[model samples]
Target: MHGRIKGEAAFRRYVARASDELRQANYTVSAVDLIVTPTRTVEEVILSTDGPKGRVDLPIAIVTDRGPGGLVEIRMYFSTWPITGEHAIRPPLLQHDPNVHEKGAVGDYQRALAAGDLAATLAAFEPQATVREPAGGEYTHTGTAELTELYTLFFSNGGGIPLEHCTVPDDGRACALEYNVTQWGRAAMPPEAGVAVYVRGASGKLIAARIYDDSNPPLHRPDPSFAGCVL
Candidate 1:
């Protein structure tokens, strides 16, 4: 879905237009990955799905923009996922997260997590909100500064890892996210599943986020430095 309108208005319009058709198809959209400019202006849109058209809610990496700028257009994809050869992955999508109780909140939260974008990720939380780890308190943060530090480490060292998240707990603020962490320094990491609860504040910004995951001995990286890391 592409719109030339300015800012969030354009995004709202895009969602409005897409919701009806998606609902009828029995496809629950937990989130959409959008590409906005450095100015924080949304310029690109991608929706992945499998339906009447060739639109792909393409499994993992749904939509990508090849911007030269003309009119805004939304491209849908079908059968997008891990490694597929000739066989096309199509509808009656059996595996999908139905935890989209709050569309906007869940969408922003999950998208930011997938993109590994720090600002967007933090923006989803409330300033005084706490982020708990399934591991322990030693790996938790509540304040903005602390959360920022925690995420800085996460984004730097914990990227390029494939993650799939969907709404859970019956369309509430909770999301069931599954991913793989390769290393925790010398320790071996395994495939993990976790629930991330995001709640909004008075201003509608994410007020708090609590994460619970299964990663063996937890993600206490020995060298949690952001030296050469890039977001």
Candidate 2:
């Protein structure tokens, strides 16, 4: 039979250390309670906490094996609860890379236009991409080569593409960017026009893109003149 003992000293020490670690890692811990089993082999810890989005209830258990020397293993479980308060939830440390990717994509597009880097701009787009313009028709292109040709003509005729904002979906599968363009030509252009571009990617490479603009229904115009155009 295994001997049971209440080792309060050891349990308190472990809880203090764990709490400090969690705080250092930027996790908000509140209302913590710790209890050590009479046998001193199991410790239960509970706390109210919040994550990047909302509040949660976290319960952790530390188990010590029966032995002459003190050895411990800890396990943590998290559950969310409805709480009303202003709490800033912390983001996961391991998710920095994906967050960086999203920022990079937005920055790339902005830089491309500011520097007039056409090649770099196109490089940011997927192979099979579709572009919709406010007064212009939709153009679907299959590859980089075709897209470049279209961009070349558009820029040659004195066109300006300006991005306003982008939204990354929570699922991380797609992004929608809002932009405007001004074309200087004999034809009169609207004072303000916008385009919403929806993009899907895999492994950081764009695989599909579709654009929504004023030319189609939201507007009373459906110019089909630019059909078969790529870019």
Give candidates' CA RMSD values in order. 15.8, 20.7
Q: What is the lDDT of residue 129 in candidate 2?
A: 57
> What lDDT tens digits, residue by residue, belong to model 1 across residues 189-212?
443333344455666666655443
Q: Judge candidate 1 at residue 6 and give its lDDT.
A: 52
**Candidate 2's residue-wise lDDT over 1-231, tens digit each?**
011223677667767876876675456434322323422333333444445555444433233333345553332222111122111221121111223223444457545643446787677767665443322212345678876765555444343344333223222444433232222222234332222333446545455444333221111232335421111
Q: Which whole-number lDDT from 0 to 100 does residue 40 have in model 1?
A: 22
User: Which prediction has the highest TM-score against the true structure?
Assistant: 1
**Collision pairs in model 2:** none
What's the CA RMSD of model 1 in angstroms?
Answer: 15.8
